[model samples]
Target: MKLKTLVGTFALAALPASMSFAWADAAPEMTDAERAQAKQIYFERCAGCHGVLRKGATGKNLEPHWTKTLQDGNKVEGGTLKLGTNRLERIIAYGTDGGMVNYDDILSEKEINLMARYIQQTPDAPPEFSLKDMRDSWKLIVPKDKRPTRQMNKINLQNVFAVTLRDAGKLALIDGDTHKIWKVLDTGYAVHISRLSASGRYVYTVGRDGLTTIIDMWFEEPTTVASVRLGSDARSVDVSKFKGYEDKYLIGGTYWPPQYSIMDGETLEPIKIVSTRGQTVDGEYHPEPRVASIVASMTKPEWVVNVKETGQILLVDYTDLKNLKTTTIESAKFLHDGGWDGSKRYFMVAANASNKVAAVDTKTGKLAALVDTAKIPHPGRGANFIHPQYGPVWATGHLGDAVVSLISTPSEEAKYAKYKGNNWKVVQELKMPGAGNLFVKTHPKSTHFWADAPMNPEREVAESVYVFDMGDLDKAPVQLNVAKDSGLPETTAVRRAVQPEYNLAGDEVWISLWGGKTDQSAIVIYDDKTLKLKKVITDPAVVTPTGKFNVFNTMHDVY
Candidate 1:
């Protein structure tokens, strides 16, 4: 509410220094229920007049307002029309044209008011990128010096910022640098997957209920700036390569009535909706490529989508959103995971829950190598959960338990600059052998890393976490000797832990342990180098909170 008065000045300052424009008005925020109701209004009364997808058959893209300037330049082409905030509101409140019926009397003023604000507001901004940009390359090693901020929170600098989908449809912001919580904002939906805008100004979350909410993390005071309704039953969202394109157009999939929708992130306007060949549940996908998981190549900035059910990896030219091309890979049981390995040269896939991590050359889409990562029998947890992480090497989790099936790639270039060149090797398999999920975080400098092998919950117990190094072939799993139980004695090794992430500073590793399958969970932090315990905090709100439990909430992943 206070933002309204200050937003005008903020907008003025945000204008590109090169451009000169008149004063603009600040938009209002919509209530959660109002946003939910707007979709119903869209389908019932509005779809016929404006194109259902909102790309101006009669109306505009609805998201991005259709009047936003093209990425190529500051000009508006194709006779695209623009509407002022008041004008757009009046049109919705009253009516337009002969066929478009007036909603003034039919719809309540409250409903009409929300749609007005929705049409006028720009898409939410992405979270700011804190890393310094180096043209060639960068590494994410842990930083030295351990200290808390003025707020008594740890200050970490190298951790990857991650958004966890709380069971209640809210999103919490955790500072990866300090292992301290920055803020937690209600997303207004049951969030599943999320992606930040390229500019790092907005954080977007797409939920299972088919709602996408964008938060303005760029501000010191994070807020859910906008909420857009995507339709029902949406799953995952991949950010389009085009940065700041109407607040990050997301390519997402749905469960029932199987289909994919490319939506304007800012306005939640459906740009193009396509039907898939098979329902995602059946795994009987057809050639109709609906987006399963979309991500842009860090190297070339091309948009890549993994058609999960079909095992299809579709690479689309970034220049033209329509210029899509596809190449199918062997069934990995999941299209949601796997992609060009760290090098961005070969496509990698987890083969049918097997320990075999397969790779294919992207150019030919043919199997190049089936790197056997330890001869362990495949644990049947359904292929859906057997996902891999992208690093200089490919790391996969086995459903069976504690064995982290790792596949190494040669770090040799004709001329490797910073790190030493090495040969292709099966650096040693560190075995903690058990029935737990595997989460891996790579160290910035060395080939050393850590994996969260859950043991139990509460009291005091000895749980083993592997801090092994995978150097050149001759070397085996060199466990980075850490002072076991050196710090945070309250953290018993018996509890189950979920996602363990490194702080931006790479100095500490934060682990979120399930409160013994109860309401008592703990957030533990480990010194990256010494493996000494830094802190252990408890949380009873492992899932949701009423009021008292809110204070106990620690994060799962660092931002």
Candidate 2:
């Protein structure tokens, strides 16, 4: 049977008599086909924030059971009073004020009703994916020997943008120089991140559906050279970046089955799989400690694998995958995406639920520090810059709070010797207009820091971006409404401006104006210095564009 068919097949049989409340009778019973369709919709749309099991992280838990602890500290449980079928349907169709996007524009009325019922039923326990299964799913479309040995096109390879065409399961390679779509190739469903190989030749993308694809940039028109299924669901993927291990091994982290897979970097052949299910930082067993993000260390021949719920950061030595040596360091929980500091020695990541940012020293393979920050820090490879007062610092925006946090970082430069005391501390918090900020970014060559609030509840703030001047810290950021700047006709659905990325030269900043599949989406480029609209690249081919990764910038780990 297909995965979707298997998804909720056990729901009816496994549900207890008490769970089948009279309220559930109001919600229509779903046929096998309806169940499959609803399951797929949830996987593509809701699984990222809310887990496959529907036990939430960033979003609220959608489990069939609800346990409420009253002020007296007594467990009040009879049935799911908080989430009846009627209430679930309303929430699914209209969404909530807490950063959840409404499905009115994205899904049809019937589809929304289907999802409402699907979540109220028992969530299926997806089958575990073994290394053998991954090997069976691996496909080498173009062998390494068959790929080109040299650049075959005149296009500026460094400026190429691997734009994630979300909802369409494809990636568009756009020329930053000419603002043209060079080629569009198939990728996984809702590709989360596009990681570049150290040599800047291979582009690796891992989607929410756990499909990892490797595209060869050396091809005449960038082609999908290799592909593999990491698991039922995946988020992060990266190639080994150390000097001797450039593109030697690839690591993909999955959300379901709670594991990560290692493969040959060139061919994407599965080598080993490691389960992340273990005790959380609090020493309690967590069955679904999903592997959130994986980063290749520059100082050591290891990969920094962060297990989300467990708050355990594993430094897996790539030199010996056979008898794999892993050093696990305990830190704060809800660990999410992160990047290297200015020195590239300290890897800083957000322990968002803990409201802290955990810094790991790769050199020592130990927990350096866990600095407290604003609520729900969602830093997307956070911005690194030299502070006028605090010396070198890292920046992160929040999802639950309205502020961009600046944490001082240690640096070796003699010029920054005076601010050594400020290292690993939250130096400042720039107030934002609203909450629900997902990504913050900056460039070494650029004079500004860029942040996006696409997750903001309000349409005005959600459709705009803020730019901060590095020279003047006291001044407020200039908010640019990118949705209006795109020059596209207004649509009823909110067009979110997200993932501000810089060109290879850092002269241009591209913002993806993500909209519904039917809406006209655009890639808005702005002059980094002038902060003026340069070009709005809108093509019918660029549908539901979200994350844009520049080839050179991503390869070098440029913020």
Candidate 3:
């Protein structure tokens, strides 16, 4: 693709010195139509990894230049590194080996060319989202008093699975027992995660577009009762789950504006807004330090908020919003999603770029340990189970390496005392054929550990999943070709398998077969003990199935 030459020498020069002030005033190199289209494309695809402010996290920072202010009011400029339009276009079109998806087919040649030039100009900054903004955006679809007082459907609520239908901006709640689509409701675009409330009655979904929806399952058919917009882009959300505070409040973390907000869990009313902009653990001010992930504490009435750029884990006390108290625990930067350990006391999260796993002792409100691991650990809520040698261990898969690192975790039980010496260390690294893994999962009752390599560039490896025997860690993982098993015609796009979820009984495991929007997508179910294909759910509504959240498993914090 031919492009206009951008005059810059620095690496990925995405902006000029005065972009913050002149973005609206200056006429850009691209037309208004090109600029608006590129902005939408970046928010939906690039912002989650590169960040809304162009600060890098799971991906590289796309900022054009760096500036520093001296103590005496003098400004210093850093060395410039500009990725010219030619290089930028190729990288965006062909993608990188670092798990970035190539957009050659997804975007037209003209659109791809437009993006290359768009990044070369000053990136447009979004307007600040305030408390009044959230209040104005809030919508109470169904009144609380008008809702069902009891279970109105015969479907087992505990075994229902909230399936994210990507690209369609909808969610399909499937019955795990009958393997049928119970209901399909319109939702936010590219719903990132489906979080079940403490009571398993309300399903909360936070999308890439920052739209949060609460689905009430007690109705005859599952219905979206409330919804709200957090910002232009967001990822994680969790309901308060403590003993006395179950489903009272919800917390959401956003990629843009670098902040988190609290809302009423039942009505989706906005409560407060707190910005996460701060200095990194390295003691340098970062403009776009975002809240990467959030999970509610089982024991304490607090939320563990992971700040990506700042490398800070904030223990936010939700009990007092007016005088909010937060205990910040410093760890490694590039923090992403994670879950509780076997005992639910230590929360283990991946600091992806740091090549480390940070365990926070929620009981003590302190940083427990940071264990070094293989490259780019991408553990989506991680897996926790008993290892024959390590006793209780949490498992994480890597995107940059073909290994699943199992780290020993502490347990208070006398039966696990012998394995205490191996605590907070990588006990084993199970081998796989390739990397680019996104999620690894296991259940308390199941004897198998499931991991997916959805991000791998190779079609064969990307469309396959591996199951490790918990009883014998030395045995090779059982690789299942999910795409072949689906019996769907092969397309040019690789149908990647991702996000393995288990039923309430842990007897069945479900995997989402993620493909292109036009390509047919499916959810493949397998028997846990036999490792045999049990069911393949393919329908017009199942377009680009990505994440599946089992109600019982998610509500109870089962890995």
Q: All candidates' TM-scores? A: 0.55, 0.92, 0.91
List, residue by residue over 87-185, the lDDT tens digit for candidate 1: 455556544321132345345666776676665445322222111211111211111122111223232312324444344456656555444556666
The segments of candidate 2 whose C-alpha lies over 4 angstroms from its true place after superposition are 1-28, 67-81
Ranked candidates (lDDT, high to low): 3, 2, 1
Error (Å) of candidate 2 at residue 159 is 1.4
Residue 81 lDDT (model 2)? 37
Q: What is the lDDT of residue 365 in candidate 2?
A: 88
Cα displacement (angstroms), candidate 1, residue 266, comes to 3.6
Q: Candidate 3 residues 71-132, lDDT tens each?
A: 23222254323244556766677666565656775777888888777766666788888889
The 0-to-1 C-alpha lDDT of every candidate, in the order given, reads 0.43, 0.85, 0.86
Candidate with top lDDT is 3
RMSD (CA, Å), each prediction: 21.0, 6.1, 5.7
lDDT of 1: 0.43
